[model samples]
Target: MSFIAIDRVSIQPNRRPLNDQKVAELMQSIKANGLLNPITLDQNFNLVAGLHRLTACKLLGLEQIEYRIIAYQDVDHARLAEIDENLIRNELEALERAELWLERDQILERIGLRAQSGENQYTKKGGESISPPPKTTVQLAQEAGYNKRTYQLGKQIAKNIDPEVKEVIKKTPIAKSHSTLLKIARAGSKEREQAEQAEQKAQEAKHQQKQEEMETQAKLAAEARTKLKEKQLIALQSSTAQKQAKQSIRSARTQVEKKINTTPILPGAELGDEWILGRHLIYCGDTAEDKFIGLLPSNAALAIATLSFEWNHDYLIDEAHIVAVLAREGHIQDFCARHRMPFRFEWVLGELYVGIYSQDPILKPEKPVGIEGVEGIVAYLISLYTKHDNFILTPSLGHAEVLIACERMGRICFAGDKATENVDRAIARWQKWTGQEAKKEKHCYT
Candidate 1:
């Protein structure tokens, strides 16, 4: 066809596939070889075809390109012609062919145009009755000389995905496999849910693994602490054992040293109760030296008495023995009082038989009497003569001389010689020798 200037035509807004890189390539080709053919347009000056070529020429900054103007009535026929020409000679890219086929089908549907019928689906009645063939997606791709697989996928995506998603797919540079998978995911709710569950499970497993690792670390730390404590305890026990052994050795050494250094004294012959002299002999002397001599007479008398009794009696009277007997008798009254026994002349004799011993010596006082008599003698003797004082006499000596004599001789005779003639006679001789009566005057006898 003859060519015309591009200024007389307008580009149609129908979708075109001119990307920046494609436009740049086309511009390079145009700069090298120039436009091989012009674009076509309708009377309204809308480009009915050759959109990509116009875009390529514009991007190359060309002031003009060749084109042909046709009336609106001829545009439809021109579009068919243009599609046929590209299918035969141009060999469009798979995606471009798919887009062209889809657009042609939509335009023909809108214009009430039918695809060419198949060979014998219906016979003509009365010269002309034609039925259009049902065009499948595969048949359309085959006619367009496009990949059946690519065309099928594109048709499925166009039908299934929302217009918004399709727009995104068209604009975005996503991989073909990923886009296919996304389309499948959009088509099936089960697939989408399953993918979400797999992602959730992966996260859960990671969290559980982290927790298990933390627990293992904690267990190891606790085990380490226990081992350390046991070691410390063992060390402490060893130290304690060492210290105890040292103390035991020291104690044993001390005891052995003490036993080696110690010495004991031998016992004396006079162990217990060995006495020196009697109270009567002691009273006969005025001093310690005089008392040693005065004891000689009593010792001689005891010796003589001992010799006399030895032939007939089992008991013996030795000087040391007589001294002990006298010392024992000296504590008789106090011994009787301490033992809670009645303190009488007979009690004094009983105390003499069993040795004079007491836990305590401070005896309780006697009951009060109308006129103190026998008890007065005891009081006066205890007050005037005790072991602490120089005048010390046995209970037997005092009781035998006073109370025994009074009991035996009768109270009146013991008081005065006038009560008995015999006593009086002895008294007269005693008085003549002393030149005084041996009677106590104004005696407070009870």
Candidate 2:
């Protein structure tokens, strides 16, 4: 151990950024107990280890500090020591750790000290160190508290990430994620290789006497490298955007499901009673029954019915201006043949059919309608058929899609379902949406 003047010690520009919190902690500890360990430095008082401790001592206004000197073969050898010291002791970010690991590996390889593959790093635990060399990659990984695969992956991240893309990544949340880094490093593999080859050719050209040609090759190489980096940036942005889109979809679905689950599903909405929800009406029985048909409004602009096993509701054509049945192709065909409704036209939406039926002649739409699943389909039909405060009729309240759509569009929904829970859910949905309670009529249609 030796003492060095605080002013004589020099820090390299490329050293890791000083951690202020760590420096503060060290200051408190050193002031309380004094520095138990000496900082490590090169012969010329260049810092090699204990950066936090050195900083603490400086802040404490210490004139000199205790340190140990290590004689290095050269600047590279000193860098290797510093990297090793940091890697072993500091809690580094993934990018920082990877950079240090790669630098250490390269320095060892350049100095002919890196151990070869299949070479024994240690014959036994606590054995003598290998002479004139370093440990194998597996051993190095183990020393770094990682498996061989993780160590190799870290090196790949350091070596493969484009510099500009790397700079962008450093400020983002994924910078600490090894898996994300690996994915980014793997993208644009072909472009990266091409850029590297171009750069190598340019370097080779520099050895010759053709100055103009060398400059041209160098410019081409630079352009290839730029394109390669741009490709990585685009790839990362696209991946991040896709991930966010999926998350948004998931979040939306989750919210819808949550509402459905939390809503009341009470039974016993009596078979022949009617309830009013603002301007909407809900019946409490099966639509196929004869008594239910008599109660139907004749002035309905459209009736939206879902396909069911009991198929006698075809008489809806006479009651409503237009009727649309949502069913599969086979079911629609079976219904058209079985019951003989108006069947004006059939519209295909993916595997589902919108069987349009009307007593009057119908005109085909000029353009195809965009689909946004079943709920959106119901909403679209409501929009096409009704004016604000006009009535819409649906036989089954299965998901209350029609009811909810009508409520939002300011159209009245005249809807019913036999299932007691279905009536309860519909009522609850309306109540939740409008922030008002529904009214059950005392009159029975029996």
Candidate 3:
């Protein structure tokens, strides 16, 4: 190699490190050793190699240094020689290598040397006077091992990025992943619209899931409430049945006691001497003096009592006897007065007395004169017995007896006089009084 004067050469301003400390050290070494290796240059005296050493000599203010001026016709071979030299030294940073590779491509293009296939150069063939430079900045970057995809994406990033953000990117080197992500962030309205659509779809899916969960929970709660209500109804029905059975047992016991206490008036006779005429008779003692009469029905008796009345062989005598008995009972007389009945013995013991004055006057008695339908009339009267204070009707008896009594009374007064209307009105009033229509219909009728 022949050495020439450094002042005769011009270094190409490319691929130089800007590190202050590294430049300072190289300047100190050049000042001491005086550039042991010469820089390489083209026939026009333009630098083709030794860029770092030339920079160090200039920084050190050296008056003279060594270099070699080669011809432009040999520049391609010279560039390849420079590249091989740098590779052996491993002296370039990634950015520096990128810049050097880019410069080599430009030189190849200027000389009309197209890179062979897979050679990564740009050039034009013969007969071309002048043409626009081949290889854009993006294509040059790709050949330098800068990712082509990234370079293509970077163009988009450069296009859409805010001026302020572009300034920041130019000043600061960001990691590749972050750079790509930022490019996406900087994309236009179309990209943003796509992102918004994705977000909305996700939100709708979440809302539908929540709504379905709520509906499922509501259905489960409703089912649980229905099961609880059914359990309560069953318990109530069981309690009612138990009460009815107890009342039945009590009524049977009362009837048995009455049968045992009754004394026969004739030999081998079943009829008693002092028989009380009423719906139910309960005997209180085992002896004559100890015996006290219980008039009217007990709750237990009323629950199961059926109405029945008959005229005996001594019907007139029985009528007379019951009349005498009512007269002797001061409370019975008072009951008649309270209910607004005339107190004369004729009025008490006449046709009216005979009418309701059999052995069991209030039972299924025969029709009296002027009472055309005696069964219906007596059914009406016995129904009134259930309404009286001393009746002692149980819950079941009260329910059935009151409903029947109301129906009978309403039928009698309003027969053929708007029967349906009267019945509906009476039923409505009765339901209001008892509060049992709905439950009764559901349980007993349905």
Candidate 4:
């Protein structure tokens, strides 16, 4: 033992951190009874034991500290000596003690000191026993004043937990409690399950909404078909070629007459408000009510499949419907310009983008009539893929385009928008152009 300058000794890298209470107690003891035990240092003057005593000396501003030097074969020897000294004292927190044992085990393994079979049996070499029995991890834990299970739990928490979480735990006495870390892990799993359930419910709600829209569209298409059948029956009753020719001539003459007779019927000029188109109770001008247009699930499905297959892209009928409408009605840009409304249309070499501004008056741009090929594709795909007579249609595309596609494909179309103003205008104009008069009935709205 010799007196050495405090500045000459350095604490070991793996030394247990100084406990403030222990250091203060040691300071009080030294003040009363003087230095009782000298600190231990390695050959290079690094601390091997008595860390708290050295800290106490430093606080007392003592320049020279009593230390005894010991030669060590390697750093591992000196590290194990320091860890063993602290662990035997039973003064370290549970986590700190577990860390010491873990480090001791690693050092022993690196030095090839595992307790192999027959390791306790002395082996004579050059008339001397070469090695003592190596200590096992369980034996070390026991020696460190901890049960096997408790030591293992503490070690697991220190090894696996997030460093930030461990830092927070360090501030509390329960920092080394294995139960605390286990509870946190369980909570994380529960939160994940809750998030998944919420996402599934949201998806189900969206699907139900789409299903309702398809049903509405199907009903509308059924009504349209009924009206079309009625018109055919009327034509069949007058089936003679001569009668047909006369009917065509009369229709043409009537359209020309209406156009030439333009007395400019003002919007408010109540044109004797009793118009009925098939099952529809038609309202003219601003008094028209919104129409619920939708397709039957079966028809909606066919329309969606046709559009998706043709476009070579996956889209719900509503989304595809809009794309189809734009593609068929090539004059959308011109219509937007004439209306002086903002309509976003973007065409990138292979992609077409279109979005309508909701604030603007809806435009009923005309779409071309013939699509025999696309119609066949819808029928073929529907029959091939559907499992039942009726199939659900996803309204991922524009309803207008989907309806038109349904019509051309000889499939029933029951699709309509929530608002009827745009659709009604288009229908009225089409009816007038074809000279088809709606059935009239005397009625008045209050």
Candidate 3 lDDT, 276-383, residue by residue in tens: 112222221111121111222213112211111111112122212221111222344443333222122221322222222323322221122232122222233333
The CA lDDT at 295 in model 1 is 29
lDDT per residue (tens digit) for residues 51-114 in model 1: 6678888766676777776665665666665565555655354334445566666666554453
lDDT head-to-head 2 vs 3, winner: 2
- Model 4 lDDT per residue over 355-387, tens place: 322222333211111212333223323332222
Record all residue pairs in model 1 with backbone atoms less than 3 Å apart, i.e. clashing: none
- Give the range of the ten consecutive residues with the poorest summed lDDT in model 2: 256-265
Per-model RMSD to reference: 58.5, 15.4, 43.4, 30.4
Alpha carbon deviation, residue 441, candidate 1 (Å): 99
Candidate rank order under TM-score: 2, 4, 1, 3
Whole-model alpha-carbon lDDT for candidate 1: 0.38
Q: How well does candidate 4 match the true structure in TM-score terms?
A: 0.38
Quality of model 4 by C-alpha lDDT? 0.47
The alpha-carbon lDDT assigned to residue 312 of candidate 1 equals 20
Q: Write the per-residue lDDT of candidate 2 for residues 1-446, one digit (tens) a residue.
A: 57888889999998887878999999999999999889998877789998889999999999999999998869898998899899878578788788888988888878666776776544423336445545689878998889999999999999999877887887465678787788778776777777777777777777876677778777777777776676667556644543443443344346543233344434357887688777887888888776667666778888898775457787788878888888865676667667777667766776677778888876433223344455655665665555677778888887787887777666777888887778888988777666667788744333
Q: Who wins the lDDT comparison?
A: 2
Worst 10 residues of 1 by lDDT: 301-310
